[model samples]
Target chain A: MKMSGAQMICEAIIAEGIKTVFGYPGGAIMNVYDEIYKQNKFEHILTRHEQAAVHAADGYARASGEVGVAMVTSGPGFTNAVTGIATAYTDSIPLVVISGQVPLSLIGTDGFQEIDAVGISRSCTKHNYLVRTLEELPRVLKEAFYIARSGRPGPVLVDVPKDITGEIGEFFYPSEVNLPSYKPNYKGNNRQIHKAAKAILEAKKPLLYIGGGAVLSGAAEIVRELAWMTQIPAVETLMSRGVMGAKNPLLLGMLGMHGNYASNMAMSETDLVISLGARFDDRVTGKLSEFAKYADVIHVDIDPANIAKLVDVDYPIVGDIKTVVEKLIPLLKEEIRTERYQVWRDILGRYDELHPLLYNDSDEVIKPQWAIERLGELVGEQAIITSDVGQHQMWAAQFYPFDRPNQWINSGGLGTMGFGFPAAIGAKKAVPEKTVINITGDGSILMNVQELVTAAEHRIPVINVILNNHFLGMVRQWQTFFYDKRYSETDLSYQPNWKMLAEACGGIGYDVTTKEEFDAAIKDAIAQDKVAFVNVAIARLENVLPMVPSGGALYNMLLEHKEEK
Target chain B: MEAVRRVISVVVLNEAQVLARVSGLFAARGYNIESLTVAPIPETDMSRITIVTKGNKRVIEQITKQLHKLIPTFKVIEHEEMVEKELALIKFPIEESLSDIQVLCQAYNGGIANVGEKMVIGMVTDEPARVKHFIEAAKRYSPIEIVRGGVVAIER
Candidate 1:
């Protein structure tokens, strides 16, 4: 059948089973928007900013295990979306972003709204295409989704010229892709799996270091099984939160900078490290020369390049996490060594007892950690929590009891400040029945505060809980600890009336300075059917504890803050 | 133990910006690309990229693996038993004896390609190591200019 380029795009999106797309349309993409108006194949959401659109798409992808789709116009629209693209790229989220470009005739001629998007995004995106003709549009769109969702998933961008969307052509969506070069290894080698199983059984101390890849590959259940059947403890990374659940006795909490004391100690003292779908990021490794010095590392990752990029791997198994873990499960069932690791468990238990995750309780004022704990207690595992980067994010990660996979989401790798509120909107859209909340710091919340209006406009009803510390809490903590308390530009005293901002955006707002008020406000906010903001004024100058001091060894953690003279 | 030189060849679909993607990977990761050569494969919509890099065993493994991750990449060749070749063209002043330069080029498997009024261009194709030796040996002739193509290698 014959169709316009714009019709073909809509058809292709429907063919891919995409129901919702976020974007901000402009002159370059007017043709597509016109077709979007004419078709009911999918819902097009108009976000306030291009960046938020991309972030919403990313959040949708991360939470639903599907490829999130977004569209934007040329020039500044594409440039604005770059940060969100990079955020998804760093965390390996499956996302497809379609950006409009100037017509083919105006390309490279410095046409208005013309930018070298494909060139700028080449390094960040997993793959990209700039469609020159209408005939290639269908294929490019099909490949974009395939590449975005397969083999260590990452964002893919497709740049379509304005003219291409108007050109008429025959539409044919390929049922399957035949790219010989893009095959992803889904099964692990039997010999390697056997060797790993044997090592797991023989080792006196073995730790399961799980990362986001496990969640991305839907291997969390299998990983949990491996840990349970082998009677081995596990440590989750920042991105891999909720993989082992909050209540599992074998789960060692998060492991890295700001990780639990016992988890870091266990990592330092383990004999064998079974890395599941996790890269040894610098933030996690902390003093690579000393990290896991006593351990023989077995890394199972789909991306072979990540196996030994920063750290040496003794046994490198390149395949999907679920498939590899499944192969090792039966082999591990043969021998259950519960007593062998008793000593290691005792040591780790003592470490946990020595310094359990704690904070000073203040009745006169609100502690950020207490607020997070209270929120978690109220919501339990029912709400899907998203957070922006800062002290608040770490507090939430530390205090929240997350037992569900994909329950806790945040900008872990890129640490983008403005990701939370918009991401919560996306997550809410992905799972409408689940309550969505954005745990944000005062400094990070305002970065995407405009999204409150997006929520109100769309009636997303995502709650934004702002821990108002009146400063960039993380940097101020650093300045207090390392620098001589010369706060510099870290102070954010000039703040808006969050209540008024929410009210003006057609949402509910509450300003609370005490615990009682916070509890009341959160409960009230959750019950409301509109976008709600609960601004809880927390103690300023608070810091994320158990710090590794950047490049220090994981074991060399500062458990408490000391007033430096 | 030490950083040694390795030659890597990658087969990639011929497309605009493919070179940028390949080179960008090296630049972003701080991998050293000592020499790089790219040309379209004959009668196919694909290109072959030959790169000479210096890294230890670990870094070399990472480099090859990273290359394979690129979407257009068809295959990455990093084999020890490989045959390598390079080409060099040297321009010498007309005053220098053409026979002497031709003898030097013959030793490296080449001869004079052009003899102009002002200069004589001598071409040579040989193993990369011998080409380096020839370039050094031709310096005694006081060549006007020297241009060396990057190494291209194939499995033996």
Candidate 2:
């Protein structure tokens, strides 16, 4: 059947099993919006801002294990989607962003609402295409979906020129994409795999360093099995929080700049570091030469370029994480009672007991960590937690015990400021039956607070628990520790009344300033039939403890001192 | 043991300081590329680069990894189990050996043509490494000059 490019786009998304899309309509994309209205096949969520649309798509992708789709019009609409694209790119989320562009003939002449969407999104996206003709629409759509969901998943942009959307074409979705330039290697060399396995067998103290790629590749079960068989304690990066169930005895929590003291210490002393699906970010490895100095690193990643680029690896396996781990599982000989594993675990346990996370009663307002822990207790293992970046993000990483893969979504690599609100909307949309909550700080929420309208419009019923510390908590904490506590531009003054903000967005809102108030507010938010925001007024001076100061060793953490205040 | 050798063809952005970036990456990663050739695309703002490197499977994989990390590199393809070719034009002296050279060039997917008086140019285009071998073989005939084109590739 002959159809316009706009209609074909909706059809292609439907073919890929997409049931919903988040977007905001505008002039250049009115035709596409009209096509969407005519079919009424898929649900179109109207977000307050285009950024939220992209982020909601990202959240949907992470939760549902499918390509998240978002749409927007030209000019500012296209520009607003950039942050969301960058977030997806940094976290390696699968997103196919479709945006409307000005007419082809008027592209270079600065037509109405015309902007270089393709050029602006080039670096942030895995690949981008401008559909100038009806003939290119079908192939471009198919290729975008394929590239977005394939190896090392990331966002792909397809800018449909306004004139092309009106053109007619026989829409046929291709079953196979034959791009010679984009062949991703999914199998590691047998020799490299064997070498990695042999290194694991020979090492005295082996540690499994996990990251978001493990979850993306669906290698969690294999990773757990390998860790158990080898008796290696696994420490995850922030993005890899839920890849393995946190309750497992062999699991050490997230390790990095704001990671657990014990996990960092263990990483420092490990003799054999088996890193899976993780780039060696600066936060994870303090100094390249000093990182895992005593270890023979075995780096396994799907992207060959990342291997040995940052840190030297004795054994590098480039392939799908799950495939590589599954292959190596059989090759490794089961050594049940390795003394090294026991000794390392014992040391970690000692550190955990000595400097446990503390939040004793004080005259000040409610503590943010207390609120997070209380929420964890109320929600238990099933609740899906999404967080914005800051002290609250780190606290959630520490306090929440995620027991399933993809249960926790946060901006780990990029640390994007306003990720929580929109991400929560996407997560709730992806899994409507599951209870989804956005744990964000007051400072971070303002970055994309308009997304509350998205939740209200879609009736997603996401619980937004704002830890209102009245300051850019992470930066303040840094100034307190590293600098002389000058509080330079860290204080957020003239804050909006969150209750009023939530109510303005057509959602339930509550402000809690004490532990009792916090508990009641959380319970009430979860019970509310619509989107709810519970603002817990936390102590502004409070800091996220167990922090490793800049250039400091993991073992030399500056633990929180009650006497200092 | 005899060293294993392979020729790699790379398509990259043609701009100032791109060659330095590509070659610097290889040098920093300790990859010893034997023969390197680079030139601009005839009708576009892109360049084609051909590199000859010797190594086993592991070393080749390392070289490819380093090459892929270069920002200017558009694509990298190692000529293994693919149709590969290179072209060269050698200006030779007009002599009785012209007919013999023509027969040799034809055997390797090439032909000899007389361009001007006392100067006959023989051209041969084959697999890049094979072309290198041909150039060395033709050196015995006292060829006056030789110019080789950078390699280009297409997946089979």
DockQ of each: 0.84, 0.13
The docking quality of candidate 2, as DockQ, is 0.13
Per-residue lDDT over B1-156 for candidate 2, one digit per residue giving the tens place of the 0 to 100 score: 245887887888785556766676577567777777888889977898888788766677778865764445678888877676678898888763877788777877898855677878888889877888888878767789998875655567
Reference-based lDDT, each prediction: 0.91, 0.83
lDDT of 2 by residue, A279-298 (tens): 98887887566788888889
Interface RMSD against the true structure, candidate 2? 6.1
For residues A91-149, write the lDDT of model 1, one tens digit per residue: 99999999999999999999999999999998889999999999889999999999999
State the weakest 10-residue window (summed lDDT) of model 1 chain A. Answer: A556-565
Local accuracy of candidate 1 as per-residue lDDT tens digits, B120-152: 999999998899999899998898899999999
RMSD of 2: 7.4
Give candidate 2 regions above 4 Å deviation: A333-340, A361-364, A563-565, B1-9, B12-156
